[model samples]
Structures are given as C-alpha cells and as structure tokens.
Target: MMTRRGVQWISSAADDPEECREHWALDPRSPHALPAGRYFDVVAVGQRVGLETFDQLQRHGMPLGPVMADRASEQVGFFLPTWAKSPFDRMVRQETADRAPEYRYLGENSVVVVPGPMPLAGDRYIWLRAPMRRPEASLPRIAALAAMFVAASSVVARADRYGREQSAASVDGGATHAH
Candidate 1:
C-alpha cells in the first residue's frame, strides 16, 4: 500500500514477493530502495507501536511469525532499554532465549528480534553512524529501531492472516476471517 507519506508498503499478504521488490526498487521516495535481491535492514513506517498495542494487533488478527536468520521477512525484531529492569525485560529475555542460537543483539537491551517476518530482508546487523559514546546519539537509533519493529510486525500479522485465509478458502468453498 502506498501511504500518504509517499512510502510504498507491501502487506505481508501481498500476492508477489517479486512484485513487491519491483515496486520498492522503483520508488524514488523509498529510503531503503534497492534493486531486486537486495533488502533494507528495516522498513520505516514513521510511527511507534507499544508492546501492549502490538498485543492488541494480534488479538485483532495480525499474528507475528518466528524469526529466521536466512529470511528476514519471515519475522520481526525489536530493541529495548538494557537498563529497563522491569517485568517486561524479563519476559523479553525469556523470549530471546527462544531465538535461534545465532541470534543478533546490540548492547544488552539495545536490539532484540521478536519472532515474525520483517518488511525487509537481510542479515540483522544494525549499525548506527552516530557516536554511541554520546548519550544523546542513542535516541534516534532507538526510535528508528522500535518503529521498524512495530511496522514490520504489522505487515507480518496482516500477511500471515491473509495467507491463511487464502489457503482456507482454496481448501473449502468459502473463507471465514479470523478475528
């Protein structure tokens, strides 16, 4: 879907992965634009989604998927405050432990990949050009990472549900939307 911001986004339920790539590649407004086969580290959606909100999204039918090293678009990743010693962090750690042995991270709470397909495809190596030693520099990177995760999760959930609906419909004479 092309947003008002001029960003062309592909729903996880998109019919053609190749076509999505083609559209992304052709869009000059796309910051992560690349030719076929290449992928951006994250899909910028220009907003933030809280964890609770993400849960609500799932309740509404967008289910996040597991993360896979070989396929970034198969899962979503996130970043949290390393110093955020809360119950949320503990839950996050437990989930992180479930990730594949070759999981990626930044600092302790810096980067975390939740299980779900990201909108982009590539290895999960986040690099910030800003000076990490400066406290203020961490702000933008953190915000960007968080937004990427939320946006990606939205795509994954929608796509996953769409795929399932298509499959179910094909199997039977009609399809029922899962809420």
Candidate 2:
C-alpha cells in the first residue's frame, strides 16, 4: 500500500504539483502528465511482454518499484531511477533492434501520464505494481530489467509462433484432398 507521502512524492514528479493536484481534485480518475527523466524514467513495453518480464523478475526475487498499466495504450510502464535513463535507453536499443517486443523509453523531453495513487472507477491507467515503502530504493536496476525483458520476450515470441503454427496446421488438416 502506498502512503500519502509516497503519493505526494509521485505527484511532485510533475512540473507543477499544484496543477496536478488541481486536475486530480477536479477528476480523480483523470490521468495527469508528468515530465519523465526527472524523478524517474519510464520504460514502456507491450502489455504481454511487460507482464511476462514482471513475472520473471518477481520469480527471480528482484525488487520492483512502481509499475503502471495503460489499458487505452495497451502498454505497461516500468519506473526506474533518474540515472537509469541513458543506460536503459542503450539497453533497449540494443535489445530491440529488429525485434518483436518493442520498447519505448520515456526519458528527457518526454511526458508520461499517470493515474492517481488510488485507482478509481473508469480509470484507464492503473498501477499493476504499486509503489512500496521507499519506492526509489525498490526500483530495479537497468541490467536486471533488461535481462528479464530479453528472456520474457523470447518466451512470448516462442509461444506466439507455436500458436500460429498450430492454427495453420489445424486449418490445413481440415482440408480434404480430391485424390
């Protein structure tokens, strides 16, 4: 569970905390834009890939910080420390250069819309993994996250290929030959 102080710290990532607060006050379910690469940088991945990576990380006992899921975009954002932007970007570029699992790194000159601390009805963005105590300390390092992503993407790709092959085989097998 996130404490009030944790929420305040997260909101402070915005350029204007007051503006963010005002927006949330007007519509609690509304998402507010916060500048990336300040308090943290966000690595956005497809929902499936992200979930797989997250599961792998958890299974490996790696610490996870705040993670948000955007249903409208079908993306999951993993928050990393501010200093991780450059390394994470490099890793993403290297890992995803001509790959199925695409990654979007929101660093400097980027904006990320995040939901309120507590999710509400009709919220398009919600926390899949909420910030825990000492959120910053709980963030995963670039190497750990990158490795997990690579492994997870491989698993997802293999599964997708297998599914496609099965469907194709079923379709072909259903056809009758003239003989």
Candidate 3:
C-alpha cells in the first residue's frame, strides 16, 4: 500500500516494478489500461469466470468486450466440469509445479486440512493472487486454453461422423439383434 498526497492506496504491490505498474493499478472493473502489453487476444472455457469479472466491470462503468464460447480440445471438460480428464486438474497440477507451496492444503505439521466433503453453497469460487492486488490475474492461462479447444473439437467431430457412418452401414445391411 502507498500513500501519496494523503490518498492511501492498496493496489498492485508486486516487488517487480514493471509488474506492479502493469497489473496493480487496474481493478477488476478498470478498462484494460495497457495501451500495449503481451496478451493473447483469445479465450477458452475456464476463462468463463470472466463473466463474474466483467460483471464487476459493468457495475463500475467500465466497458466490456466480446466473449465467445471457445471450442478447444483442452477445454473439453474444464469449465463444464466433467471428471478424470478435466483440463482444470492438469492446469492446477502444472501451476502447483511451477509455484512455491501455497500450503492451502497443509496444516502446521503438514497435515492435510479439510473443510470436509460437505458441499459449499453457491458452487462458485475465484482464484485470488495476492500482494500486488487484482481480483484475477488468470488471463494468461485463459489465452493458452484457447489453443486446446481445436483438438477437443476435432476428436468429437470425427467420432460423430464415424458413428453416423456405422449407423448408415448397419441400416443398409438390415442387421437384426435379438436380446
């Protein structure tokens, strides 16, 4: 936090000067103030959380941008959230690998912490990064996800066509099953 001319501020306080300058100054609702910054101009399913983020933008008089449903192989079940092959799982693992331990899962002796299996209401959550503040800095991951939708869509389409062809061939042959 900084106080300049008696106006105290709690914004991006990242020790990296440039990072603080780029991300800390903007709130979830601020018009993306960077006239230029490294960013992918696309999005994927997990980025759907932007619905909440953008709502904040609208509430604060900020302009909203285009949002499209992405179709990446990587996003097949991430946001829509099916089990086993969720992209969110792999993404979380990868992030954990790249990050220092958050200890979100650990107790003082490294014991597992649990709020138990009880479902939390609202079924909603947000990923929060700290220090230099922003409601979400998840944009980079979203951009990367836009690439995976293609692979998922390709496999789905091919399976659909194969199923259709098999059905046609089966009908043409007058196949019969007695069970």
Candidate 4:
C-alpha cells in the first residue's frame, strides 16, 4: 500500500506497540497510506468496549493472540494482544502498571489462550511487559511540525501579498469526496 508519495504505513496502528507510526509514515513507501487525506490512526487504551461491538467482531471470526513486543515496544518490554479483525487490539496486565513513556490501557474481555492447541478454562498464560509511554518519540515530530508550519506560513504570507487570493473553506463543507 504505497502512497503516491511513497510513504508506507502499517496495517493497524493499534497493533503497533511502539507507537512509532508517524516515523513509519516518513518511510516514503508503506501500505498504510490512503488514496487521499492526511490521517493519523488512534488507539484506544483500556477503555470499556460495548458488548454488542465486541460480540460482533468476535462472531466475525476474531482471533486473539499474545502481544508481541514490536521493535518499538521491545525497547521497553510491554506486549499487547491483538484481535483478528484488527491487529491494533491489545491488552496490558494489571501488574505492569505502566508509569513511564506509556501504559498499556486495559480492554475488557480479552481472549482466553488455550494450551497444547486447546487451552482449557482455568488456564494461565504468563506474559512479560515493559513500561511504556504513550506517544513516545513524538518530540521530534512536534519540532518538525513547528518548522513545517513556519515554512508554510511564510509562503502563505508572501503569496497573499501578491494578491494570490485564496478562499477559506471548511474541510467538509458538504463535499462528499472519499479520503
């Protein structure tokens, strides 16, 4: 899923443990790019989910798996679980109590892992997790954004002075174009 500009994106930002999604977007070639619009993926941490939605996704054949510490999470040690419908689905244990760069917010009703190809009830699966910070490594991006805004502002000012008229329009002013 390479964008015309050649930026690559992950299939599920929710599944990405490191939250290095913005950097991955800079790669200039990724499957995450949409045909249009600048979109940033958001992950919901430990928030309650509706039973209906959960059941719907589950009935759709959602598979649960242990969270793998991605390259980003590897730096820490937190692992998250993902759902079959979306890889971003993950879970954080209560013991980890993330108090650093990020914390794995808990979600209700995580899948029970079976053992020996069939984990029965009353089974326990031990997982290792490292403390994490939400939106880690985002400082650099903020700096970059400041710089980009300044550059764009300067250009816009110059253009306005030259009478290059531009109209202010809302993003969704009754336009129904696809992203």
Candidate 5:
C-alpha cells in the first residue's frame, strides 16, 4: 500500500503534492506522461512474460518497486532505480543475442505514461505494484530481474521448440498414413 504522497511523487510531474492532487481532480481517468531516468527507469516486457515473472517474484518474496500495465499495448512496465538503466540495458543487449524475450528499457530521454493514483474506471494504465515513498525501498536489483528474465525466456523457448517438434511429427504421421 503506497501512500498518497508516494503516488504523487511517482505519477505526477508536479513537484508539489497539492498540485498533483489538483491535476488528478481535473481528470482522474487520464494518464500522465512522466519522464524516465529521473526518479526511476522503466523496463517493459510482454504482458504474458511479465505476469509470469511477476508471479515468480511474489512467490520468491522478491522486492518489486512499481509495476504498471498497459492493457491496450499488452505490456507491463517494471520501475527500476535510475542507476539500473545502464546496466540493465547492457544486460538486455547481451541476452538478446541468445534470444531473450521482447522488452524495452526506457531510461533517459524516454517518457512513460503513469496511471492515476487511485484505480478509476476506464483507465488504460493500471498499477500492478504501487511505488513506495522511499523509492528504492521496494525496488528489485538488476541482477534479480536479469535472472528472472533468463529463466522466463528459457521456459518460453522450450515451449516453442516443443510446439514446433509436435507439429513436425504430426505432419510426418499424416504423410505416412496417406502413403
């Protein structure tokens, strides 16, 4: 449970909490575009993979900062500490060479749309995990995320390989029957 102040700090562009509240009052359903690489960086992954990783994180009792989901885009964004941007980027590049899951690391010069503090009806962006007031208090480290991504990717890759093999076998069986 994040405090209102915490929500304001993370979701609002305004420095003042009161101003943030006023902005929210104007249109609670509307999302706000907050610049990345300032307070935190965003790592976005496919909704399916992200949800799987999120569940694993919870089961392992790992720290999770702030996570937002874009229903329309089918992506989940995990907020990391600003310092993690560079290292995470490097890791992603390396991992991608070996067929990593599709993801985007939004750091400096990137803008992310943050949902309103409270979950309102008809909001496209929703928070899976709210930010803590301390910012880093609940944030997971880059190493942890990297490991989870690798694990998830392996599972997906194996599933894909299995599916392909099954299809090939089915085709071969059908051809044999025809003969």
Candidate 6:
C-alpha cells in the first residue's frame, strides 16, 4: 500500500535577488553574493518528494545548473539523472547512498518544505519519500562540491574577463581606425 505524505512547504526568505543574497549569506555554505544575473531559482512541480534534495529535485526537470545547496555550504547537493554518467554523478550518488535510510523510504517521516511566499493555497496532499537526516559525514563530499563550484566560478570569471578585454580592444581599434 502507498503511504500518504504531508507537505512541508519550504519557503525562501525572499524571492528577489537582494533578499536571496542576504539569506544565502546566512547559510553556512552559500556565497555572500551569487553570480549577478538571472538564473533558474525556482522549479515547479505538481508533486514533490519529501524535503526535496538533489535527487528529488532532479526528478522534476533540468535546472539551470548543478544543484548547489540551500546555503553556501556544499553539504546539500542534488544529482540529476542526466548527469548520471559523470564523475560528479558518482559523487552525488555515493553521498545519497551514504545518507540515512530514512531519506529513501516514503513512510511516515515525509514532508515537503515549500517556500513561504509561494502563492500555493488550499490543502493538497501527495505521496513523498521520507527525508534522511542530514548525516554527520566526512568533508570529502563537501570538498568535491567546493571543487566543482570553484571550477565553475573560474570559468565564469575567465569568460567575463575575456569579454571585457574584447570589448575594450574593439572600442580602441574602432577609434583609431575612425581617424
């Protein structure tokens, strides 16, 4: 028999960039300032699993980038099936495997944590897997996550610098040729 699940209704402190930034900073694992620009910050699903994590998040659809964490820390990251073939996938899977068995079970301990500001109203119930306790595990997974984010940041930084340099060069070249 399928067990009935309850929604936890997870809510972000703020949906806007400024508010997100503030809240992100408060998280032990989030960056003080996320990359400046629009990104996929929300995922819509008709039904969600308990305390959505990376694996659960992936069940919905593709997000803009890798699922980092609720905060700046790498303690919580989700894995996408599309990424199943990558080394990162292995890392995520291992982490998921090592988590408490409760997370994988859809018994009683399941609840969905939705954003508080979401316009969702009325009582809607669904089945969800029980969430695993945030285990006190080794830092290796966190280290792996840090490496992934650092590499991503490096790529973005290099791209931004290159773009700026190209823009300046184009402007200078155009001015000289105009004379």
Which candidate should be chosen as best, given TM-score against the real structure?
Answer: 2
| Model 3 TM-score, 2 decimals | 0.25
Task: TM-score each candidate.
Answer: 0.29, 0.82, 0.25, 0.18, 0.78, 0.28
Candidate 6, overall lDDT?
Answer: 0.30
lDDT of 3 by residue, 1-179 (tens): 21221111121121243553344244322211211112112223333333333334445543222222222221101221112133434544454424322111111222111111111322122212111222133534332332233333334456778888789779879565555
* Top lDDT model: 2
Q: Report clashes for each candidate as comma-separated counts.
A: 11, 0, 10, 26, 0, 18
How high is the lDDT of residue 94 in model 6? Answer: 56
The CA lDDT at 93 in model 4 is: 19
For model 4, give the RMSD to the true fold. Answer: 21.4
Per-residue lDDT of candidate 2, residues 21-112 (tens digit): 77766765677789997787888999899989988888888867788889888888988887786676667557764753568878788999
What TM-score would candidate 5 get against the native? 0.78
Report every candidate's CA lDDT: 0.33, 0.77, 0.29, 0.26, 0.73, 0.30
Ranking by lDDT: 2, 5, 1, 6, 3, 4
lDDT, candidate 4, 12-121, per-residue tens:
32334234345344541221211111123222211112122223333544322122112222221112222111222221111122321132322233321111112222
Question: Which parts of model 4 are misplaced by more than 4 Å?
Answer: 1-136, 164-179
Off by over 4 Å in 2: 25-27, 90-101, 137-140, 174-179
Cα RMSD, each candidate = 14.8, 3.9, 16.9, 21.4, 3.9, 16.4
Judge candidate 1 at residue 61 and give its lDDT.
47
Sequence-dependent TM-score of model 2 = 0.82
**Ten residues in sequence with the least summed lDDT for candidate 1:** 125-134
Per-residue CA lDDT of candidate 5, range 28-86, in tens? 65677778887778889988778877777777877667788888998889888878866
In Å, residue 146's CA in model 1 sits off its true spot by 1.1
List candidate 6 stretches off by more than 4 Å: 1-138, 174-179
